[model samples]
Target: MSWTVWTYVVYLLVTVPLTVWVARTLSRNGKVFLEDVFAGNDRLAEAVNTLLVVGFYLLNLGFVSLFLRVDSTVVDVAGVFEQLSVKVGVVALVLGVLHFFNVYVFSAIRRRSRTEARRGAPMPPQAQVAAYGPVPPYAAPYPAPGR
Candidate 1:
């Protein structure tokens, strides 16, 4: 096989496994966060987590396949390595960006949920403002030195 073919093969071998590992890690480590984000609704959290993993797999694998082409001919082992570096580097960067984006979104959800939870039923007015005038004067318990 040509060096270009070899490069393609190696790229697939590296990127696919890396994608799988990242997805698995995210799913596993993200469960608790998701649950909190969903306000401790485990079932909902699990369902959403599964969907996210599926989407992640679809998006990344599709990207890998679509990006597999080597625009220039790979004539040597160095060329193969160079192409692999660029391709794999792009994939890794994409994964990192996606991971951080997911974290940011879920973190926002979690924060909102906690904020709502903290804001329980509004407290009754502690004391109603009888009027809006500032004509009150201090009446000391004991008359001033010489009232």
Candidate 2:
């Protein structure tokens, strides 16, 4: 209905893809933080990236819509340009936040998995019981003295 609405729509159309592209580029580069957060699994990493992109879309779109509703009216070409500048600036900010969040989350997963691996594989349920003491009656003991 207003020029601000059109500007907001254009802002989303341009910046959401840019944000996703930046995130994907960072993913492809595979830094320690990204690998740590994604647990070094390529499939899981891509899936997490996809989720972040979706969240970015939702967040940016909502922000643009909200900004449109605010009292941001411009009387002429200069005014429209001013609104565009503000809109683009905000979009850039949202993208930065999404980029950092993606990096932070994946790094956490990678670090957790690395810690687990360093500790050696965990004992299976039965092995755990055997390691600590005897098994519970329902668990059935090992081979009863080998026949």
Candidate 3:
């Protein structure tokens, strides 16, 4: 087999497993996070988790397939290594981006949920302050020449 073929094979071997591992890890660990974000709704958490996993797979695999094409001919082992490195590195970066995005979104949701939970009912002011009339403008360091 030519170097391009070898590169494709190795790239698939690395990226597919890496994607699978990441998806599994995220799904496993993200359950608790999702639960918290959903305010302990287990069924909702599980459903969201499943949907996220499916979307992850579809996006990652689609990207992998689209990015599999080698721009230049791979003539030797070095070429294969070079191509594989770029491809796999890009895939890893993409995965990291996706992971971080999900975390950020869910973390925001969790924060909002927690904040809402904490704010049960509005409380009256501890002490009321009388409104003062609008204050006059502050004097300048030096009086205006025309003053």
Candidate 4:
């Protein structure tokens, strides 16, 4: 019945499942681009997924712990709910923004990789700008056969 208890319940109720949902959605939607971003390495994608989940847990836990420590000193259920709602709402917003940032960054990386791939491969040594002059055919004498 205490406000602290309610605050905790709401915090967990909202944060845990939401984070899982976002991570799932991201992993699913980002699959198409992940291959390009990290060279189709499933292991890298798994690592990224693990890292993201860990980071999400740490950040959301920090937010919950900090939110619970507010100095208001008020013990009313209403006050607790009000502050908890605001805190959880802010956390949701932050998660959304972070999700978008993750997607955008990876998308950019993927685009850069694709661009690099699409560009013609490295020029052969002989075709480089420094070697533009017409080369004598392989059959030509190395030094005017008379030499």
Query: What tens digits encode model 3's per-residue C-alpha lDDT throughout 16-104?
Result: 99999999999999999899899989999999999999999999999999999999999998899899889999999999999999999
TM-score of 3: 0.82
Worst 10 residues of 3 by lDDT: 126-135
Give the TM-scores of the predictions, in the order they appear.
Answer: 0.83, 0.57, 0.82, 0.69
Candidate 2's residue-wise lDDT over 102-138, tens digit each? 6676567667777887898667899777779974778
Worst 10 residues of 2 by lDDT: 30-39
Model 2: residue 83 alpha-carbon error in angstroms: 1.6
Summed backbone clashes in each candidate are 0, 6, 0, 0
In terms of TM-score, which candidate is stronger, 1 or 2? 1
* Runs off by more than 4 Å, candidate 2: 1-13, 16-40, 121-147
Clashes of 2: 6
Q: All models: lDDT?
A: 0.92, 0.65, 0.92, 0.73
Model 4: per-residue lDDT, tens digit, 22-112?
7677667666567557887988877876777678677766765666555565388788778777877887888878878887888888888
Question: How should the candidates be ordered by TM-score, best one leading?
Answer: 1, 3, 4, 2
By summed lDDT, the worst window of 10 consecutive residues in model 1 runs over 126-135
